[model samples]
Structures are given as structure tokens and as C-alpha cells.
Target: MWELQEVPGRSKILIHTANYSADVQGCIGIGSNLAPGGWWVTQSRKAMQQLRELLPPEFDLTITHYVPEYP
Candidate 1:
């Protein structure tokens, strides 16, 4: 799911997250305050912490943090 996104000025990598609560799945977007393009993803808090560590020390991001969007 993470590898699907392709945007310019963005890094070429993927991250995955899971949320199976027998109800719904959650997702969030993130970015680098250190980079130009913000990051986009769906992941757990621990996963988020992993991202924070993986990302540069000055990156910024946005997260849905709770509910996943459905279309």
C-alpha cells in the first residue's frame, strides 16, 4: 500500500501500517519539516516512531491518527 504512492520531489521508498479492529482500518499522511514534500502513510504509533527515526532529523508530517478514509 505504501509503495503505491508516486509523487515528485519525494523519496523513493515505502512504509506499511495495519489496523484491523474488526471495524475499520486507519491511515495518515506525514511529511518532512526537513524535506520539501511531506510524507503520506497509514501506520501505527510505533510504526510512526519508526518513521520518525528513519526520516531525517528535521522532517515534518501529518497523520490521520485515527480513522481511515473511505470512498
Candidate 2:
């Protein structure tokens, strides 16, 4: 249920974790941004882990910090 996006003006990485709500918010729009329906969902923690491991090297992505106090 996690998501990530590389906004044009952003310099750091962004990672969305399913551990919280809104993890998939606005995520469906990514399909229109990337390709013709490439967005998919992951239900397993292992799958999420793989994504976490593999995504950074593929792009200049930044991991957004989730401050415990905020949520």
C-alpha cells in the first residue's frame, strides 16, 4: 500500500509506507503519469521490502521520513 513520487522540483527521495493510512492516496494518478496502467498493489511486507531495496538505485528517489509525532 506504499507509494513514491519524484516531483519535478524535489531534490530528495520520497517513499510512502503502508504502515499508515493514505498510503495509496493519489497513487492511481501515477498510472497516468508513468504509463498506461502500470500501477499495482503489494499486499506482502516482503514485496514492499523488495521495492524499498530496488527502487533507489533505479531513480533519484528519496525516502520521506515519517515523524512518529506527526502520525
Candidate 3:
């Protein structure tokens, strides 16, 4: 498990594998794609394994939130 650092007013935030959004609590979940209706993620274990192999032991991360425009 990887803990996030320098998050304001938050502690113990980790990046881990979770099959669904409901499986996580205030932490980042790793997955390959979003399930139908975007309620949760899929292929979490595979994604996590790929991440483990691709990423270094420690590194900097940046997260950005994007909202889709619907007509």
C-alpha cells in the first residue's frame, strides 16, 4: 500500500487495488476501466499489478478531476 503525503487535513490516504468504489474509503482505487454507469471500476487487480511493475518505489503524483460536458 502506498500512502499519499502532503494532503491537507487528510492522513493515511493510500493508493490500493479495489474492485469497486464502494470498496474504498477516502483512498485511491486502481482499475483498468470504469464499469457501466461509472459507479465503479473494473479489472482492478490487473491494473494494480501493471502499476506496481511500472511505477517506482516512491514517486510524485498529481491528480486532476475533469467533468464531462453533456448536452
Q: What's each prediction's TM-score? A: 0.24, 0.28, 0.86
How accurate locally is residue 40 in candidate 1, as Cα lDDT from 0 to 100? 36
Q: Which 10 consecutive residues of model 3 have the lowest summed lDDT?
A: 17-26
Residue 20 lDDT (model 1): 35
* Tens-digit lDDT track of model 2 for 1-71: 33335466544333443432355443321121222444344443554566666666455545475756633
RMSD of each: 14.7, 12.7, 1.5
Q: How much lDDT does each candidate structure score?
A: 0.43, 0.42, 0.89
Residue clash pairs of candidate 2: 13-61, 13-62, 14-62
Alpha-carbon runs more than 4 Å astray in model 1: 1-43, 57-71
lDDT of 2: 0.42
lDDT of 3 by residue, 1-71 (tens): 68899988999899999977677899999999889887788998999899999999899999888899999
lDDT of 1 at 8: 49
The order by descending TM-score is 3, 2, 1
Whose lDDT is higher: candidate 2's or candidate 3's?
3
TM-score of 2: 0.28
Cα lDDT tens digits for candidate 1, 1-71: 24424444555444444333322233323322322343332345466577766677444444344776969
